[model samples]
Target: MSYYDVDAILTDAQKVPCTFELTVPGLGHLEGNPGAEVKEGTKLELPLWLAQMLAITPAGTKPGMITLDLPDSLSQKVTNALRADPRTVELRSLAPHFFNLGTRMLDLFEEEELSDLLTESFKLRAKELADHAHNPRGALGEGAEFLQGLDENERRLFRATHEGAKAVRAWLVGMQKK
Candidate 1:
């Protein structure tokens, strides 16, 4: 997650559910009530950057100003779907930076199940992605649906794998000519 990485920036801009733990003055614009104070216990979907800061920053003796919850993308429903069939889940529909957001969330919350599930899902999906990438006709054929569901990182991996295979073939052809 480099400072200049566009994907990282976009991932940080993704919204996550948050509940205000303490009422503060003049912060209602976040909830679309400009010039009004955000009341305690108000729930809002805030960008990951803002929500993370507010959720971790301490106030006096209290822990923080807001409590952060998992975004809808990482909800129990999505988890169950991934557990059932990682290859079938449309990760891009959930979030463009699904894995990246999951990594960031894991940094904040400790969930062994989520951690293991994400790792296993990625491994499974990557194997499938590699297979599709290596097959020239796969993208346009039955694999199209799965390819379309790839998130940012997976898409990059697919492209790299596809291109690498192409390059290898080209090299082999040149060798044959020689």
Candidate 2:
């Protein structure tokens, strides 16, 4: 079933679950048009990892914190839905403020179609960062240089990711005020 077709809760109010159709292929579907409303029953593909993420089983999924990497242009209706529902608080830990810098950078690009040049560059740089992180066994600020090349407007949006992280942390902290 698609994300839009997803049943938040089964008849007994249990969390509805579905298995992924494909492993590495992953789920991806359009969210209506960019500037218009999507009719009901619109198909929204759900990736395999997401199915595991929402799965009721463990040892099948990565325990503790996990991040679902998504494209910048993507809009997950289920994320919003789950976020709104009190029963789905388990997801909040992995959802908000997980540092989706990929989407943030793409948003900074403002591209209707991502060019091959930019895509290739990002891949190479990402590999470099990955290698650096792996070798150092510590951390990598490798993205800082490429990120620095972006204009102020882009940096503003990029920084917003960290800001969102801070806000989520603060919100959780304040919730303890109860």
In TM-score terms, which candidate is top? 1
Q: What root-mean-square deviation over C-alphas does model 1 reach? A: 1.5
The estimated TM-scores of all candidates read 0.96, 0.23
Which parts of model 1 are misplaced by more than 4 Å?
58-61
Against the hidden true structure, what lDDT does model 1 obtain? 0.95
Tens-digit per-residue lDDT, 1-178, candidate 1? 5789999999999999999988989987888899899999999999999999888854566678899999999999999999999999999999999999999999999988999999999999999999999996987899999999999999999999999999999999999999
| Candidate 2 segments exceeding 4 Å error | 1-114, 120-147
How far does residue 140 in candidate 2 sit from its true spot (Å)?
11
lDDT of each: 0.95, 0.36
Poorest stretch of ten by lDDT in candidate 1? 54-63
